[model samples]
Target chain A: MKLEKLDPTVKACTSLVCVILLSFQYLVSLNIAVFVLSLLLLLTCTRARGIQVLKLLLPALVAAFGLFVTGYFHGRGTRAEDLQKIAAMPYAVRAAMSTGLYPALQISTRLLAYAGFGLLFALSTDGEAFIFSLMHRCRLSPKFAYGILAAIRLMPNMVREFKSVRLAFRARGMQLRWYSLPPVFTMLVNSIRWSQCVAMAMESKGFDGDAPRTCSIVPKLRWYDLAFFSCWITGILVGMCLLRY
Target chain B: MKWKLKDILMIAVCAVLFGVIFLGATYAGGALYGLLLPLGMPSLGYEPFYGLYFMAVAFAVYVIRKPGVGIVAEILAAVIETLMGNFFGPIIILSGFVQGAGFELIFALTKYKRFDFKTMALAAVICSCVTLGYNLIVSGYDMIALPVLALMLAVRIVSAVVIDAIVTPRLADGLARAGVLGGYAVCEGVAKDLDC
Candidate 1:
């Protein structure tokens, strides 16, 4: 079944669990498996384009490589004894027997696994569907859910305002540094004004924090959500057990 | 305390703004990390910008002056960041929660009254510590050498204090003075101070 067709809440929950569990486990093979499987699922089950997935993975790849180098050089167990042990090993085995090699691989692969799960949920789930699901199934307060939804809708306008503010500054012959505070402050002030107006509009429409409300789009939990969740969990558990032995 | 619709929207918009900033910081941090990779302490790169992450909590709590606003703002910011395609993924939501709770603990201890520099600085320090502990476990910072780890912690705390404590309160107060935060608790506090 298509992962896009699965419940967003379920996908999010699974991805969160996967990330947490993967953090604790340092098994290189398991991490590689999880990363590959997540990528495969994204490519096959979800409508996420291969290029899109690659774009998402690019940062993770760069980070993983940097981490590997960091761990190799500054990682724990780089003492004299560890160095001597590595030196004593045969030439072919020396690289593999380096003091921090194992930990480096573990850390890098774990990062990849995390990115994989993150991309899985992010690419597969629609933001609106996820929010509505939280409102319907997770019982999130309408106050916050709708508030967040409204703010999400305003994001593009905020970006546009940010650019216009910068242009306004430039038009005045003022070159604002990237870390300049005035632009940010201006944006914050504008956000406050906009939020106040939006809030007033919403309140005028009888938006009440305490009042019960009906939703237009309600995402349901299907049998496949459970099936996929259990299958994913069992796969990880089995991989862990087999790797341990 | 009852949260008005205005309070909710204010937090939401501020969170969205900060989320965008946080995403930009992540890219900046990534570049710095790559540059510092040769120093054998690439982890320190991100430490300096750690304070920017807590601005949402600091700004929201200071303006709203309510209990639990920091946590809500932070988590919302994280959700927005994740939706914006953060490279760190959904797990950042957990980091957001931890960072928010760190500052919230300080405000809670003050009985949600103080929004002063001392209080914010203390909150920033506590937030640095809390998130540091989290990274030690989740990000595998413990595997790094002791000296580097200590250095990272120090840089992170200093960054947090500068950004969250120094910059955020001043910006919020500036907004308050500009009359944009008219009906909020910050303006009320400012008026109360003038009466004294």
Candidate 2:
């Protein structure tokens, strides 16, 4: 990205990048620790930081509350302290349960982290530059990468169209009943047409039939990206290595 | 009336939408599962509802009412899925073939005569089996009991019906309304087909 608009895009791209990177942490406790740190990073960084953080906490809270309620009513409120009481059951199941929660937590964190990053990218990074990065650094063919990226950018509009079409039907006095399917079906067909129309328009404009193209903007990985990435890895490694107790 | 420019665009768009759904689900599902296996989950898995991918062929054939189009749509979807970084890597290509065929069989039974509710359900059912068979053969899920298989089958059937019967029909109708499905007799007359 040009120096003018780099900060936000890199941040946004990283969330997805980080999640993709997150798959590497499948071995042990490091995964959980990394996920927690990522959640923290996303909270501080995203524009709607307070609300975003709250959104993150909501699910975990829900899960924990559900777990607590289940244990309270069903398991007599099993707690960490009661580990000794249920000591008769085999260790593997217990171990697995504890580990299971960690992954779930991390999974949500990774997902939200990507969303935040997406926000950062959408808000800051120039879309063209970002696509260029994948083309240049990642070696993705410029043609395919840009074509798909352009298509993906249409996703929000597609979803919105879906909503409006429903509204349009309702405005026309059609009720959206379970058995009623025509109007909704028509909308689906229309969506398909829109894409093809766009594809054709692009084709007419020489977009789909090209071998490859070049971009004026090239993403240079700056000191900030390196710094943030290093800190991210170091936190996870330290957390994993030191928390062995 | 003949196939208009809008009709061609619409049908192509529907085809792409189908591709997107399949690719998106597979890519996201596989990535999520892959990530979960390491950081937190080593034991369980999600509800396995993307199992609907297995029935793509049947869904395509039923709605599109063309022989090769169903197969092409599924394969294209799988390719998109891979490009999106589906967790299973290249194997997704192979899965697309058998799963697409599973749904295709139901249509073949009616000899491609109709896209009626019964045929649609049959397509979904056969597809569910195809996916289950795939999971049993290639996927490493341990066979627990008759009950587990039964449960999985039930979930799969419900999902397929919802997808094929409800979602697919609505889409077919929309295209038909927009004059997109003019060439396909089965998908035609949506205003009369559901008798809306």
Maximum-lDDT candidate: 1
lDDT of 2 at B2: 28
lDDT of 2 by residue, A1-245 (tens): 33223443344344434544544332224544554554554445444355645543444343333322222222212234334423544667556555224333333333333333333333333445554565667565544454455555555676677678778888999888643545446556556556556756766776542365655666677797766656655665565456421
Candidate 1 lDDT over A189-208, as tens digits, reads 78778988998998898888
True contacts kept of 1: 0.68
- What interface RMSD do all candidates show, one decimal each? 1.5, 10.5
Q: List the DockQ of the predictions in order.
A: 0.69, 0.13
Residues B10-34 of candidate 1: C-alpha lDDT, one tens digit per residue: 8888888877776678789888987
Which prediction has the highest TM-score against the true structure? 1
lDDT of 1: 0.81
